[model samples]
Target: MPTTNKKKQKKSSDTAVQGTNDSSVVSKVSAASRGYFRDAFLQHFVCKVARRAPLINRGYYVRWRAVDHCVRRFLHITQKCPKKQILSLGAGFDSLYFRLHADGALDGAVVFELDFPDVARRKAALIGSNITLMGMLDACSPPAAGPVSISSSRYRLLGLDVREESQVEDALGAAGLDWTAPTLILSEVVLTYMETQRSDAVIGWAAKLLPQALFVMYEQIHPHDPFGRVMQEHFLKLNSTLHALRQYPDTSAQRHRFLQKGWEQCACLDMNHFYEGLVPEEERARVERLEPFDEHEEWHLKCSHYFILTASRGSLLEQALLAPTAGPICGPHRGPAALGVRPTSACLEGLGMASARVRPDQVLLTGGSSRGGRGAEARALIRAQEGWRSVGVEPSVDLDVRLHHSATPLPGGGVVIYGGRSSPLSPTPGLFKVTFDPCGSPAAPDSERAEAAKVRVEQMVCSGDPPPPRWRHTASVVSHTGRDFLFVFGGKNQSEPALGDGCFLSLDQQLWMKIPVEGAAPVARHSHSACSYQGGVLVFGGLSGGGRPLGDTAVLRPTDGGFCWGRIDVRPPPVPRYSHCAHVVGGKLVVVGGVWTHSDGVPGVVVIDVSTRSSVEFSLDTTAVPWPLMLHSFCSELLDPEEPELLLMGGGGNCFSFGTHMNPRPVTVDLKPALGAGFPSWS
Candidate 1:
């Protein structure tokens, strides 16, 4: 590269990297404003304060929480020492020093923050101008010529490029940093912006200089998955690419990197592990209850791609190491080993749509928001001589707008649709009955059925009590007194954390009916799966009230008098997941793709043999799928009762700030290999 061009590129890169600091402080302010954390200083750094989406707020909260955890741990362990210090790399408008001082946690520790010269000057100016901020600092002198931007007894802000080791060392020495003290070095989403070689050199330099230091870092990882790819692209577009993601891609790799960089003891965990195992449960629930959040898929995916690590050289800091509060996650990441999928031309795609087989050859899909907005018309996927094709149908009556609804196939015929909301604030009321019929005779040719499928949708008005307006619930046909009833359970509304009470609607009368039940009920949840099993329904997996994924399985069986709930234990329990689809065929519960907190990849097929209480998992090979097959907030159904083929359609969510990813077309998953040869055909 030419010298002139190299210099220009470097200048542009530095500007772009520094620009990230502006956005970071704004998000932190948003998070703190929403009670996710307590930070009075961040608001002063931003020009204007604005509210962020719940997902973004939660993301920043975890980042803030992780750093606080490290800081507190380090302070407690080194409290007895006469003098200790904290060195924050790329601190960029962070108020950690002020926050610690206000909390009185900085009794004996001094905090040194380093960033670019421009950023340091900006931060120093903000501090000098604000009366609230000025009160926190001991007498400080204005920044002038050298690397030291702000000088105070407890806080020293420096402007030095971390890539230049000798300059940083000399600057720290001049700032009165104690080299041999029990120092805590913090780097949150930093160091990844530079070239790999530069970042590695920085890490090595810190380890060599501070023998009794604890290095803390929080940054992105797992750069190969769909979410990861989007995250990488988001940064690349900003002209600040993440350099560490490819090499230090996971917790294990990150741990090894620090160890190889001359750190003696190190521990690393993805944010999901930190949030679950390390943070207290009550506090998590409190944060969750602050806002009405429905973006479980994005929250978990965002957490899995970031990590918190602590590395120590001396034994004093070893006690501050991050350790898991619980055991290892159950089941291997199942197989992303690529289960074969047959390509299909089914064009129907949208999240929160409901799918059910109205006939052996016809599947009805209704009521979901699409790129064009909430679909007013219904669609039917009919099997033809060539293949399954989706055809538009005009319903007899408007079902209105529905998202995260349920479509239950009736034993006698027709379908029952219930419980969905157009948006978080508007849950559709009452019941809907949708029936699909072939255009011609009952024995019409497959080609003709594919040409023009007819659908009828009607709102069913009933006399008995109906469940309150809600979405993300499950509805299934369970038999009682030789009559099938639409059993509805587990969902959330705008105000409730989650709805646990189950209600039964008689299919024969279209009236909400009550039947006797026994045993403990499942916890309040939403976005789970329930399928008909032996005249009852088997429910599995959902998001709990505390915003955690659930993996327990239970059966509501038909006793002579009513239904009874009983737990079903499967060895090597499937990893807890939510926002996925499920179906029962030949006594096996086959769970399809969904979002999980497992560190590396999305989940695949988890087939639980309900009869034997055994389970197996398989991964989806979307090699032929058109786009990234995000399978959550989508719908799936068995194309044929006798075959192991399933169709997944209409998923994708707002991927944090990366962008919205919606599966463009329907994809087929062939589960023959996942379910071995001897499986009996579905009758």
Candidate 2:
């Protein structure tokens, strides 16, 4: 646990800096002059963008590459540090975690993202379920921690405004983290937003809080070059789009202040060297020669606009010196913590406030947590709140019903639920359907609602024969010969001793037939993920009864009368994992978060991509033990039509040491829209 010390500091003024000095100005400034300053003011702060949208495209690639270089270096140091506690101070939706999560980089590192309340809220919404964040947006609200899955754990997003010394201390103290541990501190594109002196005080406080903590930062060195002036002007003009930029270091004198605050001056890497590393080797050589602005421009003299700096906590003398006579530090903001907020434990196990989808213009909900028996039940209970409505298909016979995972809606309107556990009382053979009549409006009349509800199951059934009695399997609807078919593969049957495969229930036939899998078949397994593309079902990763996980990849082609299976040599096999969700975005199948243990014996996510056949891993940066989760459930949605990003949600976490993964918490991830060549096409 983190040690607490009682310390207090007096507050100072937070008055805005005056733009005009007492210069004898006989004439009023013109509108153009006023507009110039306005533009610069707006250009001063953080600009918002979609989380996965490449920062490279936004012209922040230079800063981003610098950040990555610094982090990679720090991670090397952290890899040496026994206790890896990563704190992203004023983390402004930085994609560091995204890249880390993509590669499963932080093993044994407990990452804590700290920011002001408003910023934390936005980060939470955008990074929803992608990385586990720590701090709660509304302390009064229920905990946001979802079920722990085998592959991943929740992260904390602590609301700590750097300006508020007390709140900063409070959040740190509450984290129960060991300050003695070697920590990596990141302040990216943030200090410039704050008064220089305040930034210094924060640095001083951080040094005292964790003397061994290493700092990595990127800040705009005061730009006087024409380019620099334009950049500043650009910010000021788009004030609504951009926030205020506090004092930027114009001379080396300003950079000297950080060292005075107890930072051990480390190496500084420039933007050109950084971005040159990102592009292809051939392009990189060319990129290095390219200038951001014209040579004739004044801004061209401002050394690439921004610089990446690394420092360690030590005597300020080892680094740059502070101003001989530094200004006083300002106190915290006077207003309520922008979005007023206020942390949790084992009730027992691991978590969502509501299970239903919320719509715009919906009324605020105030209710208790309802563990609805099935997905439909959960959705129904949550949708009962005013302003939200539910549309879901319950498994014809319940075993374990997952609302979003097992069931998906067709392009037209009908609903499909496959691979649900069959009831012990009455096992289902396979394949069930419920057709929705949106045209038969529910608001029309009681008769219409009855008629819509009364549609017979047989009428919805297709011509193909039903598959076997298998639960804990995967099924997806793919189009073949201009018709949609529910493709099923590899599931455990209560009756059959081993996992089975290759069954297709034609939406048009309604019958279920066991596909005669030919060629090399994937290993017999259950709980594996299956996705439909073109006229094939791609299967990956699952566990056999022997308890060992399988890493086989196979595709089932729907040709002839039945489906045929073949193993396409995935150049590399993913690490054995189960309960991970798979989604086809663009043409890549993203296999996200699955269970794994650290060298220190802690559980977290181990992600792998078969397209490249590489192992990626991420660990919770905080010490909080996530619920041991596996096999609870998972669901995916193509959130944006244009981008093709996938949103993954809901899975169980393990609460007991029963040695089995069973988390009931919901996890989420909004992946980068897949891009590239040789992608599959769906009919």
**Which digits, one per residue and each the tens of the lDDT, describe model 2 over residues 1-683?**
32332121111111111111000010011111222111111111223212211112223434444556556655665675566677787665544554464456676666677765655665555544432332212122333332111112324566556778777777665664577777778876566656556777887887778877777776655343223344555444433111223343332444465677766665443342233323345443333233221111111112245556667764421332111122221111111111110001102111111121122111111111224332223222111223223233232343243221255455565455554432322234434444433233423443333234321122244565456666556767766567776776676554543366666676666666554556776877765778776577778777654323456677777776656777654433345556556666544566654422101212223333445543333332222324332322444344453554333233442111111122332333323322322222222
**Candidate 2 ranges beyond 4 A from true positions:** 1-405, 422-431, 435-465, 514-516, 558-563, 596-632, 644-646, 657-667, 673-683
Candidates' lDDT values, in order?
Answer: 0.85, 0.44
Candidate 1 ranges beyond 4 A from true positions: 333-337, 371-377, 382-394, 437-454, 677-683
Best by lDDT: 1
Error of 2 at 368 (Å): 18
- Kindly report the root-mean-square deviation of model 2 from the true structure over all alpha carbons: 23.5
TM-score of 1: 0.93
Over 1-683, each residue of candidate 1 has an lDDT whose tens digit, in order, gives 99999999999999999999999899899999999999988999999998998999999999999989989999999889999999999999999999999999998899999999999999988988999999888978776589898999999999989888999999999889999999999998889998888988988899999999999999999988778877898899999999998888888988898999999999888888899988899999889888878778899999999999998988787784588786777654353345776667666667778888776667788888777555535887776656667777777787888888988877778888888887777788868788887665435555566455667778788879778888999988888878888888999999886889899988778788778899888898998998888988899999888778899998999998898999988766788999999988887899998888887477888888877777777877877764667889888888766677888877887888687777777778988777662322231
